[model samples]
Target: MEKRNQKRLDKKMLSHYQLQLLDDEDKRSVFLIKLTPLNSLLFFTFFMILITTLIFLGLKYSPLKEYFTSPTVENQAAYKNQLLKLNERILELENNLEANELYIKSIQAVVSGNIKAEKVDSLVVNKFHLNPDSELFKPSEEDSLFRIQIEKEEMEAMKASKNTVPDAKYFTPVKGFVTGKFDLTEKHLAVDISAGEGDVIKSIADGDVLFSNWTPDAGYTLIIRHANDIISMYKHCAKVYKKQGDMVKKGEAIAQVGNTGELTTGPHLHFELWVQGKAVDPEEYIDF
Candidate 1:
């Protein structure tokens, strides 16, 4: 009897426990399952491990990994590097802009005759230096040829102008008193002569009438082209007797003086002389 009782106890200890679902009032089992404690513990542990593994995989392989991991040091460093490069580019652009502004100001000063050509040449040579290996900035053979041709032309022009004499026998355009003189600083390139109304204005030299027209500023205007690149302009005329392309002698009647244009305050003639595309004092070449 003692041996049999020990065998039964051992079997009971090894048997699985009953798990049941029942109605509370009827006390009837609707579903049932049996599991040993060791098996149940093993199943719960495996299920928990599986759930943890799935969560880890989801975070690792998905966009949620950013939230789980620390921020990337490489990305931060790359962004900083890009910002630094942009700053450097900005600085370079600013430097280029400053250099360009200085160059433009120097050019303007040169054009206005405020600075000497020698000074401007020296400034250009000192300010701008071309890199030896830069293809775009280097001067080409064609450029050198063009520069040489320009220098040759300038030399030829200078030689032609060197021994030229001023015209001492230029005809008087009108008998009048000079009221306004040529002043380059004032931008008045012509001399204004006050004359009687309907006073005859004559051509200053033998030339072809280049322009004969009326303007709002100088009502009846005329321009004559003469030899040696000399040009004469007569403005504020009451009447013009010549037309464009008409040939006239040195003392031919070409116009009459009057306050005809909006710029004239009274009967006057505004006379201008141009030599080689530069405005000169008309009094220097013509007797009023």
Candidate 2:
């Protein structure tokens, strides 16, 4: 009986209710509403949802967004500084590489008789404050005596200057008739010798092979650096037996005659001689 009574009370609390308003003087009903527990619950849920949507939109589209989502000014500046340092490091590496390339080219120029080695020496000396006109370059009494002795010896042999032709004998590179002569005005700095195919080509003097490589205009080219600042070049060869830095004696076989380059017409050897950074007629110094 008690359980039944409690059930009846709960049902009555959950049941519908009526709300009304009446005109006080006219004594007439003006409005009325019937409300239920389910309707009240639905209204409360809708109000909560509307409040949540408003908060989300304010966060997404208002100035408050940056406060939560964007990086701080200090962090952005630090990143920019890191990028600048990286750029500076890359620039320094590029400059170093360029300097190294220039150094290598300068050495090659001296070896190939395109520039005097003394010029390089002078440049280095000047950089270190040891130029000829500097006080540090003044010779002492012993140094003066040594210079006098060396000059006297050179004078007696009729070889006072460094440019005097070396006493070393030159060997003919190939037995052939001249097809082209060295001409400075024509810019043909080498002589073309017409030889039979596969004829042996020899080194003219004792030297180390400075370069042996293929090029479009002078294929199978070989360059040698000899004593007394002299250089020899052989181009348009059928084959080469020596490589860079290999030493070859005078008359040693180094290559074979052939038409191997785009500049060639028939089987031949193109030979050039350079002394003291100047190209000279090979026939003047070598008997072909």
Candidate 3:
């Protein structure tokens, strides 16, 4: 029997090695592979790079990417929370818009006369649903007397006020011949006073300017709210010297006469006097 022997590896073997595949019949080399320390290291590096590239491409483009990118419970909950907040915000905006629309509608109703202004006073009275005949609301004898006395005083004051204005107290707004008079049949509620162009128009009484703006039919117009529930309207002016909310005294120059409105035939002032919301004859109040 022959004994087998094993070879020892040293520095020379670690440095370089070779492998060969030979033909069994002639012992001729069919394939040859050479290996070295540096060559082995370069091959291992390239192999690792290829493997890593394959793994990276699979994760980036394949369905297996969902394992890392798909939403978990916490992520889904966060997204749902954001959606709920957005929904709540939208609902809040909708509510605010509805409230604003209702408010605008109420104002339009009042302005268009669909809701009577006097009915608003009734709302205040009806709020508590208390009957006027209730004992708690009944007036005593002294209260009745006091109310009567107050009413008498108010009547006397009104009478005195009427006389005070009739005695040349109201300043004439313009000095001009009347081309148009207050005629209810013609629906001419305002008095048309014809004057030269650029004539300074004055206020008839001490008041605050309620409106000073241009209208298509009335042109440059100014309206003043005076004491004792009196309102004066002056229309078809060339220029307005005062703006809305200005304070003016009697005979103060507020505008210039002009034929600027669509309703005007020539340079004139369309003057209107209203007392307690009713148009009255300006001739009765002013001597113009």
Clashes of each: 0, 0, 0
Candidate 2 lDDT score at position 205: 90
Best by lDDT: 2
Once superposed on the true structure, which residue ranges of model 3 sit more than 4 Å away at CA?
A: 1-168
Over the stretch 162-272, how does candidate 1's per-residue lDDT look in tens digits? Answer: 223454567889998999997654667789998999999999889987678776777888878788867788888999999977999999999999887787799999887
lDDT value, candidate 1, whole model: 0.77
User: Who is ahead in lDDT, 2 or 3?
Assistant: 2
In candidate 3, which residue pairs get closer than 3 Å at backbone N, Cα or C atoms, i.e. clash? none
Give candidate 1 regions above 4 Å deviation: 1-164
- Model 2: which residue pairs collide? none
| Clash pairs (backbone) in predicted model 1 | none
Residues 27-95, candidate 3: write the lDDT tens digits: 999999989766787999999999999999998899898796777799899999999999999999997
Model 2 Cα lDDT, one tens digit per residue, 199-263: 99999999988778776667788888788878898989999999987999999999999888788
